[model samples]
Target chain A: MASPIQENLVSKNAEYASKFTKGDLALPPAKHYLVLTCMDARIDPAAAFGIDLGDAHVIRNAGGSARDALRSIIISQQLLGTKEIILIKHTGCGMLTFSNEDAHGLVKKNLGPSAAAEIATLDFLPIKNLDDAVKGDVEYLKRSAAVPEDVIISGWVYEVETGKVRRIV
Target chain B: MASPIQENLVSKNAEYASKFTKGDLALPPAKHYLVLTCMDARIDPAAAFGIDLGDAHVIRNAGGSARDALRSIIISQQLLGTKEIILIKHTGCGMLTFSNEDAHGLVKKNLGPSAAAEIATLDFLPIKNLDDAVKGDVEYLKRSAAVPEDVIISGWVYEVETGKVRRIV
Candidate 1:
């Protein structure tokens, strides 16, 4: 059963399509950079980060996990010619609300024992300190085998409350 | 030194923050769904998909690769409470432009031998066909033990030229 919001997506998209004009952008991003950020609904990467049409690749995940995003990051840089990266985690992220044990318990309680066992080895990538996580993700990218040494990678924290970004590294 | 556009990011972000609102939404998405789509700047997932504040988690990557997004998908559904998935790929994506070998050669040519050696085994997750790719990703998510069987996963192809999405699975 499609939800009302899902149905709205189709109709609203049609309206957007009627007025859309920036559909002829190039394959590779014009600015030749990429950003790894969270899938937080509070943030709009395009508007908040000032990324124009066909400007950059934005790889977003749960915690903005660098490890989770590395595969796409490699492809973005190697295949698409992006030379820089901006990794942005945010304040008040749900990833900060729980530990691995907490996540496991939630899975077991909500999904069942089989589902819990299925994800037993999974890392939720939870972080205790926001600043440390940002700096660590930047450092991880710097040391990554897949990321070239010359590719400039910086880290920042996007404050969902204030809609401001604070550079952490 | 930040690029000219990177500098624009700071200035633009400041402008956005000055008028920011709607930062008090709940932790869980209001609509309890997620959209796994491409990082292509041409597509604005929020506006195109009619995702309002705190509506859904939008997981984006190169080619909108579901394999790359699996970790976050698990977290979004299990840890968070999203019950549905919208897997949307687009036409004429950069992922369709190159194969793994082409990416490897570009890595070597652009970043030298050592960098090429680092990502020698990378799977760029390139798609040869758009509709088939969307179906395949939906199937992949359905087959994954991590994704619950009851979770409604649908596939669509977002046409960059026409700005319309066609259902594939």
Candidate 2:
């Protein structure tokens, strides 16, 4: 039996597929750019950032950490020809709420020692300041050897409270 | 001066924020689940997967690689209370088009030897078979010490040609 969420997926997907017509969209993003943003439940990158169905790649993760996203970013650029990256972090992010040690301790408490050992050395990439995080990710991408020098890179903070995105770097 | 893409973001974000009202949602996803999907341009997790604002976390990376998204997944479950994982990869993904060696060669040619050397040991996590890839990721999550055994994990393939999602595991 499917979970309730999975059942929701089936019915909603059926609804979406019934009217879908952009089946012929190409593998490469049509506008040759990508958006890297937080996986925050409240932020919808396509709606807020004005991305059409086939316009750009949307890469989301916890905190929208650029270091964590470097692998995906490289593949998006090298293999698929994306030339621009818009990296957006956000205000009131969970990354700003805890430290790596806190995460380790939580795993130990929540899932016991085995889980703790599995992630003992992992860095959760927590953020100290929202503006600095955005600036830092943009700078990291700019200096990354894997990222081409000429590729356009910018950073922003998405305001979950207001749904506004302001440029940060 | 901002890039054209950045300009688009500013204008579009203004439009979104002008009508925004859902500012009271909590930090943790209300539905306590996450959707891990490909960063492919054609896939919109919100509309296709039936996720409302503040409903679930959405983590996207190249090919929706489970390994690539491990950290974010850990954070989502351990800290944010997500109990289910819906991992979805899609047909016509760019990841289906290249091997790790092919990616390396493209990097070497496009961004020089230094760029290639930086990612020399990095696995791009390319997928060869769609169904096996979905099943493999679901199995990986099931067996991983970091992911609790009680977490409900399922895998699916989103067909870009038809916008339909079918379960694989």
What number of clashing residue pairs does each candidate have, in the order they appear? 0, 0
Cα lDDT tens digits, model 1, A29-50, are 8889898899987778888888
Q: What is the C-alpha lDDT of each candidate?
A: 0.84, 0.92
| Two-chain DockQ for each candidate model | 0.64, 0.86
Question: Taking candidate 1, what TM-score does its chain B reach relative to the real chain B?
Answer: 0.95
lDDT of 1 at B40: 79
Model 1 earns a TM-score of 0.93
Residue B53 in model 2: shift from native, Å? 0.4
Isolated chain A: TM-score per model?
A: 0.96, 0.98
Instruction: Name the best candidate (by DockQ).
Output: 2
TM-score of every model versus the real structure: 0.93, 0.98
Instruction: Determine which window of 10 residues in candidate 2 chain B has minimal summed lDDT.
Output: B2-11
- For model 2, the stretches where C-alpha displacement exceeds 4 angstroms are none
The regions of model 1 sitting more than 4 angstroms off are A113-120, B112-117
